[model samples]
Target: MEIPLSHFEEYIDEPLLKRGLSYFKNGFVHEPEEIRPGDYEAVVEGSEDYTVKLSIRNRVITEHSCDCPYDMGAVCEHVAAVIFYLEQEELGLTQNTKKGSIKKAKASSSKPSKRKTLAQQVDDLLGKATHDELILFVRELAAKDSLFRDLLLASFAQYNPNESKTLYTKQVKTLIKVARGKYGFLDSSGAEYVSNELSSMLGLANHYIRKGNHKSAFFICTAIMDELISALEYADDMDGHLTDTIYDAFDTLATIAQEDPPEEVRKLIFKYCLTSFSKRSFSGWDWHLNFLHLAAYMLSTDSEMEELFKRIAAIPKSSEYEVKKAQEIQYDVLLKRKGESVAQRYLEQNIDNPSFRARAIQDALDQKDYEKATALANEGIEQDSGYPGLVASWYDWLLKIAESQNDTERIILYARYLLLKSHNPKRDYYQILKEIVPPEEWTNLVEAIVQEAMERKPYYRTDLVASIFIREEWWSRLLDLVKKEYTLDQLAKYEKLLAQHFPSELADLYAERIIRYVENHVGRSHYRTACKYIRKMIKLGAREKADEVISQLRQTHYRKKALMEELDNV
Candidate 1:
């Protein structure tokens, strides 16, 4: 789906860079992805912590279902990368000749030359053909559906509900109406055959629903739903990944309600969606999830969904979907299970796990299982009572859940644990702080907490304390921290960490780090983040301030000694 760079520039089409800059204060690192020829689904490194099944085909995106709150928001970077990569690909075509010569020639060929249809063209791109061949094939077939194209570009981020949407917009919707008139509704034998099936599903269902034929609409929609699920089962590489596809189908289905079924039928249909989901064999903690979606569909309406949810809770252990989903969906299901039981079960199963347990807790919390979460947090503390180790898993676990709950005292307590017991955990605490208090609030916390800690001990947690001053956003603090904390000898250690971990933020550090690097570095003043801040500062009527910061950064104490020493050696 990548377009040519020239086409990209001309059309104001957002590249991943522009896209990132739009959404994030700091530019996003767009991890590149590739087309898996085996399935034609786009593939990227999933957040190792969560099981989001993201894929792309044609220039269209189909993301895996995520339990993260952001999932509904379309917040995952994998999805962003998949979508942007597809655009990058479509535009990658602009570099080639605009002759339409390839298209003419491909059309002349008798072979299954791969650009005959949208689906086929997608198949061709996913094939081993060179980039040029793929684009040529696609361009030959690519008749831009203007409204459809816009619907796509608009929905890529999933960052805001008001901005994007849970389903298609008004204009693109005319497509279904237009097509339904052409094709007509009421395909007999309760089966359908159509190209662009999701599209056809919309058209045919709308045709029936528009006529007050809710019976036909529901029937056809269910058939299309079955086919969509069947397609997921049929896809090669993404075969096992049904959660995402199912959710997409669910959301798509939500939009197709021509007339809300009678209260009786809606309840009946809701029960079927809930009860029948157990018939399938779902994996991991997924089996229990089917009900979550079913319940969301019902509860989001005028009807009371709690009794239905209670039925799900009352499912014997003999039922499918597993315990995690059960505990997680308690609030949504209206079962009123304590978050503590859920957390205890999760912790008991996940003991001896470290890097991944955070992921587990986040997922559980995503489900609103606060009681089990509290229990798990308490259990983690008891399992390892020693301060250093206990705080590693336990205190941070509570802080993580507390952040979601906005428990400032819990956040401060965990911050104290890291500051007091493990100086090395400074970086970890700051990273977590971003999730809790945000960047603007960090300094206030630092001022209050660091001062309090200093009264209790000398050197009050050295490793991460310096992180607060790295932001050019807070210039005065940066200068003060550097001047007060580091001696001439310690500058080397401090500068190295800045280069490695805090490079993006250090640009605002009065440019001392960048200036020092100019001597040893061939790319003089080569820091990207630093240069970016300089421009930002200039734009804000702080040109003189910017220059002064840059100069001080260049001439600072032993900060530049390494750069100079290295340049001389070279």
Candidate 2:
């Protein structure tokens, strides 16, 4: 086995570093006072033609110097050798004893004998030792035994053996020594382990999926997954460190099913991820996130699975099934098996839960139950005062409900409630009301008046805005309003319509109006739309203007920075 600094450190005092350096360069005086109890100096040899001195102080080798002709580099292999020798022989520090038969014999054996030649030593260091031994011998050099260290590292090189043959050179040896200490952390072993297992399991499952072996692959993968669930009981969740090899083993076993991983494999995924099957018997590894996802995506082909999981993971862990990340993992099961109505009711039942409440409100509105949607929105308002949009949404619905029933006073009451309670009265609620409710109830059409007063707004952004503009019959006024709000973002989105086919001049202006409104944040989601515009500017060769416009736009630095980075990538 090659000797590492760590392993060497175990055998010798760390102070030997200084001695090892000196020993590599020149021979040192030999003092066998302890070995003989009379002589006080020992002569050590070096690679270069020189003898070295070693002054021992406080049981430590100190004050070493080499005399090699070209030895400006100081500490050489001769010094390193002397230190290594003392360490391997387990020499005592400042403790001299009676000469034993071994030392007396060694002294006689050492006297003027022909030692092993440099060429023979070099050959032996390379062609024969174990990896551990080879590593050790390299470290023994001032250069340490670097020759063979390079060979072990060649295993990771990308080329085939014929083209770029990876021989175990001393350079490879040195690199492996350094890499194990530092770079091993970057190997992504966790991810690789999971991917490989999945690949294998997928192969087996494919045999079944192909021969219709999905059942065989399915059963095998499912069995392995079950075992993993049991082992993960003793795992770390928050920290992601898996201490149990069985978890790693089981995880690998589960991935082997990726070839024909059945739906059942996907269902048991949460058992490994969320709930511990045993107790905290292991550390959590970052591996689970990527593998479980790969398995689920393979099973479901849901491109949005990863994105939905990202959103779900951010929610508080304590949320109900409708609100939890585990729910997102099993989203297909919930949506496909039970249908949207059932899903909505599940979320609605947990409306008291902060996590599920928002989902319930959206689901109710999406299902078009105006009364149910209105009631959920009202409930959201009482719990979170700042979420005033909830109350306004209900008001918007109520105004229409009243207008449809010809309850004019009720329409007036909803409108007045909206006008009073909303924090942003200048936008949103009025924006919604200006389009949906009848003008008879609005009288002077104050909702239309308020919406038109915005300094900049997108024409096509909210369907409500366009409906209101069309109803008001202010077509020329819309054209004038759009021109005043045009920004560089409009250049491409408009130019494309004309370039791709043909459109009215009014359509181009409509594009500009939408672009400018989006840039200026006329709506809640309008921020950071410069990306769309910046892309077009470059494509149309408006490079100089594109740069200037994006630079001047009132947006985040990241928006501009991201645009530039995307340019470089392209």
Report the lDDT tens digits of candidate 2 across residue range 262-304.
5664554434343321222222443434343443444443443
Cα lDDT tens digits for candidate 1, 1-570: 222322333332245345422322222223222223212233333333222233333322333332223422324443343334334334331111233232111121111223354465667658868889866765555446654444344323123345322233332233333333323321110112122434544565566466665544454445444443443332322222233434444444454432466665566456546664544433333323654565555544434455555555566665433443554454333333435565456454544344335555666788988767777667656755755564566666676677778887788777656655664453467555556666777667767765665455655644344555553244444445565542323444454444344443443443444354443444334444345545544554556766776565556534655433433322
Q: Which numbered prediction scores highest in TM-score against the true structure?
A: 1
What range of 10 consecutive residues in model 2 has the weakest lDDT sum? 32-41
Clashes of 2: 78
Runs of candidate 2 exceeding 4 Å displacement: 1-201, 209-349, 354-376, 388-443, 446-475, 491-570
What TM-score would every model get versus the actual structure? 0.34, 0.32
Superposition-based RMSD of candidate 2 using all C-alpha atoms, in angstroms: 20.7
